[model samples]
Target: MKIYKKGSLYLTEGGEMRDDLINIYKDAPAIFETIREEIGKVVVGQKAVVEQILVGILAGGHILLESNPGLGKTLLVKTIASTTGLHFSRIQCTPDLMPADITGTTLIEEVEGSKHFRFEEGPIFANIVLADEINRASPRTQSAMLEAMQEKQVTVGKNTYRLEEPFFVLATQNPIEMEGTFPLPEAQLDRFLLKVFIDYPSPEEEYQIMERYTGHAEPKVERVITRRELLSLQQLVRDVPISDDLKRAAIKAVVSSRSWEGVEYGASPRASIGLILASKARALLSGRDYVDRADLEVMARPIFRHRIILTFDSERRGVTTDQVISEIMKAI
Candidate 1:
């Protein structure tokens, strides 16, 4: 349990420092499985989607979940909060939602017969925040999240408050409903580490969902990890290494997207950094201490899909961002 001490030296079999590495490589997956098992008990299936969310968490990054209604975008994030033993808060985004609604606003209060202004913290203070139907909110309201996500702090009336450690924003959006839904600005989209696309469940999975739901005794999930342990895992993931060749390849892949025929805009340099971080998290989830080439390739899609924009001509031809990313993957 103390394997994560700051500077303690640990040696295995040959008295090498590999024990620390071995601990992460051997233990991370079991820890991951512990949470996945809990999630599987209630959530029918979306194994890949679940894994990508876990990758985002381990990478200490925010996630944007997009899918049509009833695909369980809400349920997935709520489950993550319950299983991780983290405090959860939700914001129902609307055109009427103001910056003060998400962040704290100063209010006058009377204490000890004296009137003074105090800052009232908002829902963004929790460890896990679900911004449901975020695109439905006006762009001005959406812009309020900019500072909170990037700085991990909310500023109001010249005062700033730091968010809790391990804080994560899991925002949801309905891809098909564009009426009155504001497309997230590029800068806002870039702030998210990965955009996870959810698809409808498989037939077999749908049957299980039906059976599990119609029962009198519904499913319950136990907390699989504590806040402290989750923080440690995030640190452990960052400690994983990558080779120069893989680094170059990742950059090359991102750079190639810039001039690709169908793309109006390509992923920025942030995509390269996100690609590396996410791949390392993937490797750690597989109980590996070093990221492999396969890890880089597997993470490319989720990290780049939202970052690139398809041209109007490409849209007219039915070209999609995912297809463009697929081509880049093959060439690199």
Candidate 2:
């Protein structure tokens, strides 16, 4: 249950949390509420999805968003980037996209009659990169993003370039569009901390969406938090305490997935790690000083859904990954 990062967390001589750290934890809800209020300016609903995205941000993890087309997935990511004041970039993935197109390429340049190679950074260099319709990209192009997403760095040649801090890849994919699309490899999918499913909005929410977009003046959202503040929040999220019992619960859910009847392949150790981290972030978002069972219950599906593979019988019976995860949690 012990977690360590490069920077130290503040604690007193008795090993209790410092007053300043406690203050930050107490203020977390208000700060996140302001962020949601800004995002609500444009997005009409999907509060749960928004919270999960915030969890990914606070956990310093990448996210994969899946939904049918025209569900505002791209708009949501854009709004989050805008609200957080993070440098944003978008890559419209397509079959023709090359590996160099994503990770950048070395280009020859001449200066003062001397020619040399210079690395040109790609769209992946931003703080928050939106890989729109990621499944549409060629496998080669998708693979190019693995290093940047996992290692937070890119290698063009013998030299490697470090991406800016707080880097995240918020990728989107259409669930129904299978034609002419390359499915992401298991390795690539494993890299995503959470796979969020965006459902259709309610009629009331849709009506409000129409009202907002049909108007002559579009709704405007202002940045609520800066990069430095967000970085600090990320650090604080890691320091949020989780009891051994809850940590064991998170691990048990992951382990149960391996022997779960419907699951063919279980989640990796990364899932256990991601589940714990996501729960800590969720607790902080709820303005709690410690992780709760509710946090683990709520985050289980997103953490394990993409990591496990369903059995043929389960697929034929129309059982989904979420259902399997739910059973695992209940058993644990």
Candidate 3:
């Protein structure tokens, strides 16, 4: 692990960070570990899922979680929010859900003696938000989040309100093939930094989960980091260094996807950006300041899965996005 203290993290002029900032980077592991440990108490399994959530949050990006029901996806998100001590909110996406429902609206209210319209903040104002079953919502309703998710601000009426730092939207959706689900458009999917998939737990882990929940109450989660520390940690994660070699490799991985056989479309430049940022976050979590090949390889799938659109022939041949991504990974 490389520990940076009161020195430039990069050779660039903007790398001249303060001493306290240096201290935060050095102490990041402890903070991350403590949060992980706290999350472990309530979450029975899905270690990888938990790590992905932390990576997305630390990277200062949004995450789209995909999994079947009863996989502890919601539990994992709640546990992460509790341990990190961030304000949490949730919206159950449905066909009737409107854009204002998530972004809030101005309504007439009595103040003292007079009644006037005031803007009330919505659930999107929180540091961590869970959009459960997001695919159930109509596309128009879903489009309401475009501004807040990308620009970190919402334009309601003539006013634009900025979201607080460390704001993250953790949305979940079932398989698109399922009924009553509106497939997220490519444009909307592109906004998410990564798409994380959760699988079923092992028999042993399942038994433990049953024993813990059915037999005993899960332990209370303790806050490991405050909002201020979280903001500093996100900054430190962005500061992690990457050599030019790895930077090109990340770009190559994305560009190759566009023309790869058995695929119709490829990831955009944003995918490249997500790969670098996510890889850096993974490295920071591992207590290393320098990103390695393994970091990029591990993050490849999540970075590319949702961004790529498979062709009809590829679909007929039973070629999945992960399968295509694996080929790209091998090629890279």
Cα lDDT tens digits, model 3, 1-332, are 34433444523223556566667776888988888788889887788888888899989999999987878778888888998888999999999999999999999999999999899998889889999999999999899988999999999999999998889999998764578889899999999998999998999998988888886555789888889888877777777789899999999999999999988899999999999999999999999968999999989998899999999999998889999898898887
lDDT tens per residue, model 2, 298-323: 99989999999998999999998988
Our tally of clashes for model 1 stands at 0
TM-score per model over all chains: 0.93, 0.94, 0.95
Q: Which structure among the candidates has the greatest lDDT? A: 2
Q: Model 3 — which ten-residue stretch has the worst lDDT?
A: 4-13
Model number with the top TM-score: 3
Q: Candidate 2 — which residues are off by over 4 angstroms? A: 1-26
Residue pairs with backbone overlap in model 1: none
Residue 206 displacement in candidate 3 (angstroms): 0.2
Candidate 3 lDDT at 211 equals 84
| Best of the two (1, 2) by TM-score | 2
Structure candidate 2, residue pairs in collision: none
Residue 284 in candidate 2, Cα distance off native in Å: 0.6
**How far does residue 185 in candidate 2 sit from its true spot (Å)?**
1.4
